[model samples]
Target: MTYKGIAISHTILFLIVAAFSVEPWYFLMLSVAQILFVPLVLKLVLKDDHLIYYFVIPAVIAVSILQITEDSRIDSLLALIYLLFTFIVAMVGFKRFINRGFTNIEEFAIDMGMMYLFIGGLWFVASVLEIDTGFTPILTWLTGIHFHYSSFLLPVFIGFLGRVYKPASYPWLTAIILISPLVVAIGITFSTLLEFISVLLYMIGIYGFIVLAIKVTYKNGYQKSLIVTSFGALGVTILFSLLYATGNAFGIFGVTIDFMLKFHGFFNCLIFAFVGIVGWSIWTPPARYKKLQFPISKITGKGTVGEKILDDYHINKTYMGLVDDMSIFVDKESLPPMISNFYEQTMHYRLFSTVHWHAWFKPFAALYRLFSSRLQQLNLPFTSREMEMTGDIVAIEDGRTNTRAWIRKIETSTIFIALYSIHTRDEKTFMNISLPLPWSSMVGILALQEQDGKLLLTSKSALASDAGIYLAFRGTIFKLPLEEQFLLEEENKILTAKHEMRIFSIPFLTINYRILLK
Candidate 1:
């Protein structure tokens, strides 16, 4: 008999059994009939291997036995029977009905079987735990017919349609159908107009599928199989719609039918219908056998190896590695000349420089005596001619340098009467310079020196004071692939001479650095 006949007979039998009075003997007899009839029917109608028949017969018997037994202690046994029945039916349908070769059939069967078993097992666990209301009425209906939800019957329906119909011939139509349910579900959950559009799209998808199915049927002679399937689909769709409408119109158990009802229940039926139709088209190619076309290049953009590396490094975190490789240098000869000029020019502007030599006390004393004699002849104040300072360089790098200095100025200074000068990195030029205490307090400067090519830079500032306390700082920066070197001349070099002082304090520090290059 055709699938439609089988479905009708099963439904009628179930209804008859459900309506009649509960009798153990009657159920036993009915169960026996179910166990015997399914194999007989399969043997007569299906042109598959006898192995399927062998497995299916035992599975049906097991399901029947489980259904006939009412002891709660046998619940695990019942669950096992149900799982077995589901597995065997899935195997038979995929292997025999799908006709995608035995390999594909076996794979699909195993995949679907595992999915059904997992779902069923979860439900069984929930039942045992008393976490959920055990098996719904639909599930019980399948059990009554010695079948389970994972039975071969649904797959057969799907496979039969695949063999007969081509519903996914239009890719956009298939996509719309698939996306509609998801959109509707979102809309219902959020209660938005967008969701309503999803519902509309879902309905459109259903209409499209129906139209496609009808067209295929008409074009290929209204074959009995297609006619029966079309009727079954129509019936199922209408039943689902009605159930959803009724549930929404009147709340179940006085609980309002919310987003789930409107989107999931009302719209999902159409979505499932679209899925079935799409599966059909994919499984059974069109008569013309047109190749499936796709733009692989468009999906994946063009990129060479170097381009990819550059893009990845720039776009991601790799640039930090590049920054870590930089180094800095200070042109020592140029620094003293720059400082001498700055002191002379800014002397009229109330700025002065001081140098501290803590390690070379004797040399510093001798130099200080010579400077003092020269200054006395010029009639400058004793403080102006003398300087004392000490500090350590904190951080030095290619782009920037930093230093801290502690300085003490004599009370007899001819310059502004400040006891100390604050040392800081000059912001304007890449250099370290000292300013009087009051001048340093009024302005702050951070000096940075960057060299592209052939550029000698000396930046002095009244602005470096705000950066922090620094006694003295000096550094230079140059790129890789150095070309030439210059010697340090004694006449060109100007050194600062100052008083010697005992080391009073020192602080320990930890430094971390990294280098990167492309």
Candidate 2:
């Protein structure tokens, strides 16, 4: 669904839920809202991407309905169904890890994200079913909230930053971050000593991400603001997390569940989850954005090794609009001899996205879709962004998105492409072939391929052998062999295309579109 669809529907649900909510229901309501907003923020706008909205919108609406009915039996049944859904998503998360191969910083972050989601799901199930694992009712629900909000963002905020910023240089700190959430979960259920250790690790992870945020910067004000607000909120979120966790393990005074709820709930929904998710949705790759605090005299553009290699075709055009009628334009003068065969091929585009090629890649694929939401819509260096919270989309024309001249060649089942994006302005980016290896050390591939009777095309980047030294030098860490698929496909009939990138074989950065040509 479009951004407006998500916004209007959720607003109605929030209002309906609010009307029927009773005292403690307020906490659940807020938590649910935060959960709903989490992906929206991740989507950089209130977008109802299929994976999330299909489950969340229905679940929330059903929740409102059940709450309105206020029947005990129905509530119990809904709780069970909710548990089942949680189990499904958990399974999906597992499949994602296996596909991503767990070797990049983003994958590590994704691993933790899945862990948090699964564990948080369990907590939610327990709270709803009223299954006592030995805590007060308020505490039990609060724990669920903790898992939902804090645990959810543990990976998301870090992962979001990791997507753009170079990896952290501190290995020990990176290890602590990768495992701290698990340790914290285990600490809560198992031992006080472990819990205490987890608390320290937790503080390290939160502060660590904040430091990373400060170290990295963005050209887009939207992304920069999210970096500040999400981390700033997380700084406070962690304090409360530690406070609440310690209270659970060792009766700390003045840190009761009620005390934390009033304070933490607002921040969780508004500042941390809401604000941070909004930022995640507006994410622009760090390489694409300029950096701050760099060595001034010798500073260079943030082009990845891959980007610098493919710079010739990387034209930045100004009029990237769809061809409403047949307007065949090709610069045979600029064409590589290898791809001259398909110069006259012009057809409409039909765009769609699925889980990445492998099952394990789905989770990451979903993330890539969220991160590169705008680029998918217009397959150039995506420069459009949504302002925070107001649902006002701010469009900046940086490239001509319409393909003027298109050509393709396949060798040994590998595809190569070159196309011109026409513009009134002479700016052009010849990027849809193989990436030019930008000034930054990022790796990406731009090509067209056919697999299983289908053609998939676009620029893609997944961290593997290429990013090892760069990630280490930047102080970021993660498992390797990760994939990011920012795709556009055109096999038959209507063509499919996107300005998207997936990390860990998941949707890391994307925007999507369809074209109807005459």
The number of the candidate with the highest TM-score is 2
The 10 consecutive residues of candidate 2 with the worst lDDT sum are 386-395
Q: List the candidates' TM-scores in order.
A: 0.32, 0.52
Top of the candidates by lDDT: 2
Error of 2 at 180 (Å): 2.7
* Tens digits of lDDT, candidate 1, 1-518: 43344445544544454444243333333343344434333433243445555555455545444554454676566556645654565455444323322122222322343233333434433433344344453323322321212122232232343444534343344445434434644554455456445545655544554555555543334343343454345434544443443444444323232432333232222233223333332333222211211111101112211112122212211111111111233333444333333222322122123333333354545555565433321112323232322111212111122221212223332221111112222322322233222112111122333232222222221222222122211211111111111111112333222222122112111111111111
Estimate candidate 2's alpha-carbon lDDT, on a 0 to 1 scale: 0.47
**Over 4 Å off in model 2, which ranges?**
23-26, 29-31, 38-52, 66-69, 170-175, 240-253, 284-518
Evaluated at residue 105, the lDDT of candidate 2 is 54
How far residue 248's Cα lies from its native spot in candidate 2, in Å, is 6.2
